[model samples]
Target: MTVDSRIIYGSWNLEEPTTPTRSRLFCLEPIGLGTAYVESLTGYVARLSETHYVETGMLILTQIGPLMKEGYTFDGRAGGIDKLYGRYTRAFNGASNWTSALISALEHLTLRHDLKFLSVLPWVEVIPLRYLLRPSRAWCPVCYQEWKDAGKQIYEPLLWFFDAIKICSNHHYPLCTKCPYCQKENRPLDWYSRPGYCSKCKEWLGTNQNSIQTDLGEPLKSDLNWQLWASENIGSLLATAPSLVCSPSKATISMAIAAYVEGTSEGNVSSFANKVGIEDQQIHRHIKGKTFPSLKTLLQLCKHLEVTLLKFLTEEPTVEDLARASARLPQLKNSTKRESFVIRHNQSSIELALKEALLENPPPSVTELSKRLGYASSGPLYYHASSLSYALAEKHLDYERVRRFEKMRSILESTLQKEECPPPSMQDVARQEGFSVQLLTTTFPELSRAISDRHKEYRQMLKTVRIEKLRQEVKEVAFQLNKQGIEPTRTNVSNCLSKPKSIVMQAAIEALQEVRHQLGWEG
Candidate 1:
């Protein structure tokens, strides 16, 4: 069952016939598509190296060969096997599904006429072409009669060709009747039979739990585990005067102060208001940078300025989410008139260079370099300029905003060193972290949003753990939640731990440590 490509005829073998005398690209009955592949492989060469072995091995897997031999789909009396058309990258070490997809795509491309045409549709074409064809086979008279005459199981003759094969009977249930390989000796391997015997070899499923995430990556962490969003730029932003990000309601005030610094006269302030979208009178009232703008309106202004949506986004997305989102991008429309569609990617070099040039310009403010990007306004535009800087920077990828625990990090480091005072309030932690006291009560919308998610995740975790017991007996479960300063109420606990997202777990640990000090817990 080891796949050795050089031992097989390989690409050339797949192309030219083995012999002019027996030369024809056709499937014969009884021999099964699996047999044809085995013939092609064994007749190609004695053996090959590991790299070619996996590469060529993949080329064979996608076709459903053994099933093809027994007539699961294609060329059989009972046909309809799935045809694989495209490939997904394969893991050479193992991962039969991925290898199968890769091989299927390569073979189909090689066989199909003008497959080059599909290359133009790279995004769509990349999807694995699963369910393309059924297995079909050719049987020689000798292979057929000897198979029938062996007095083996009716399905035994295919032993010469396939590995993971099962012969489905033409019955109402349509289940596999027997193993094509062993014929009369054994029943075919069951597909989903885990921790059970293989239908062909009657052994365990690969003898490994390749069913989990950590196992897929040999280095474990290298498999893109949800990474911590501790970017260098995040440190820079957090270091800025905390006053830079006050309550959202005070955004108009901040903008007014920024305008004042720009020397916008009172009369000119009205003009600035009209340029963005807001009341001129409101701007005059908040000119001191004390009042905030509405979170929704601030986002709208930022978007119109062509800024990174990070102004509105937080809670770093996980690797799984990113993968899912990226996968969907290939399948969706590229652009829309209202907003650039996520699918519409691949920026032009010229346009990217233009953005870089603008960012590198002195004073780098939106209005200062308006001509660089061809914009008319300067007010409420500097944010967009910063966004352009991120977009043009190759190493930096601007995605969902990630929350930086400036305060919790300090507190944890201090507390871990056993130097902190006892029982700090949640507000104390926020204040220590440079957030306002209103943060816990949802006053600071961002902090509140994060807290709400925490509550949900906490509750969910508690729900999954069934600890129905009297108060005294509930020590184990109650003690566990209490260690983190969490009440054991089904509602509160469930709400706190409801998310089950790894990010939530990480954040909650930090948040609860702050609570632990407040609860006066030494442990």
Candidate 2:
């Protein structure tokens, strides 16, 4: 019997189906996506490096650095790598140009379009970079330990990167800045950083199993409530990012504040400012869309206005809701009575205070004078006694210049005299003293040069030491393989070493040849 030709030819359209291109790297999904605890872009990079069995710095230098178009390049040398990882890594999680470039590079590598959600890039238009991100890493030990115990991936969340997020909303404990073992703060992304481990010491950062009941020095009830509110609201904002039809704008924020001002204070900005504890001029600037409030200030505004941060940015309050919110303004004003206390100062009292301040030794700063005069800031003092305020400020600046110079000189001379091993670099001293390396070099060129020279010598010594240790390790591994009747080949020797990645293959090959010669083996 013949088969039916219709069965073979039925619905045969000879068009080739289009297959999507494969990504170069694994497209690992970010943890807690669409939630406040979403994994940070830096955290995602660290995890990706681990998956590929390469150092994070190496991955960045090899794969992502070349893809960046904005002249963001990493030096492959050790010192340059250290500088990048130690000081410049914080920008990876922020809304800077580097963050945008890295996101584009990673998306190209992973072929995933959703990587921008891992950073604050989506909100860059409305969020100012100043005071936005923390300089160092912060984490909740309880959260780390809990995730570890549950065998969950211990990635850092984007929420912990915010400078405003001091406490963990879920754990209600203050986030830790320094490592428990090393007592050293770590950068947001280190060269060989791993999740749940100290980047410097490689020690576990999670809470100890036996110290589960340790006191965390909880804050007062009122302060704790505010911290919780700020953290939760900020988290809500991050969680709502993926679903936003359009990014939040300054106009939207301005309209919201303007609406509130009209409703609560009947278009009286000063009255509304008094209720909100923000300066009227600052409120005016915000309403005019000239500038945006910082994240901390924005959170405070939302809390006092009885609106969620997500709603305040995304939706405008209706007239009725604003009326109800305004009705509660009386209670807010009453509650802030202590904060709204106005200090009455006349012209005579201000002039008398300035005269006495001028004669005082170790002249007080304008800010100090303001506090002593019962004014909130130096603005009022300058307004009333312009000449006196200027003179006082100049004197204080001169004094401070001499004082700071002496302090920095003493610290630099002391650092040079110290007999510590692995001498600290100029960058280290600058970071520890909260000064910039450029400032130090410009101010004290000789001392900065000496420090740099000493650090270079120490680094050379370390390199010599590491080379010797690596040779010894390679020799040992080669001998062991030979004794096992196996060829001391490079691959075999490397596989036998404890840390195969730490050995330089050329050094290992040379050591293997020496071992083979010692064993009376032919080449």
lDDT of each: 0.30, 0.76
Which numbered prediction scores highest in lDDT against the true structure?
2
Give lDDT tens digits, candidate 2, residues 267-355.
Answer: 55677787888998898778655788988888888888788887887775666657777876754433232432244687678878998
> What are the RMSDs of all candidates, in order?
28.2, 15.6
List model 1 lDDT by residue over 98-211, tens digit each.
332322333333342211111111111111222211122212222223434565322222212221222111111111233344442221111211111233454322111132
- What is candidate 2's local distance difference test score? 0.76
TM-score of each: 0.18, 0.61
- List the candidate 2 regions with Cα displacement exceeding 4 Å: 1-19, 69-77, 80-86, 208-221, 331-523
Candidate 1: regions farther than 4 A off = 1-269, 272-291, 295-408, 423-427, 436-523
Clashes of each: 55, 0
Error of 2 at 162 (Å): 1.2
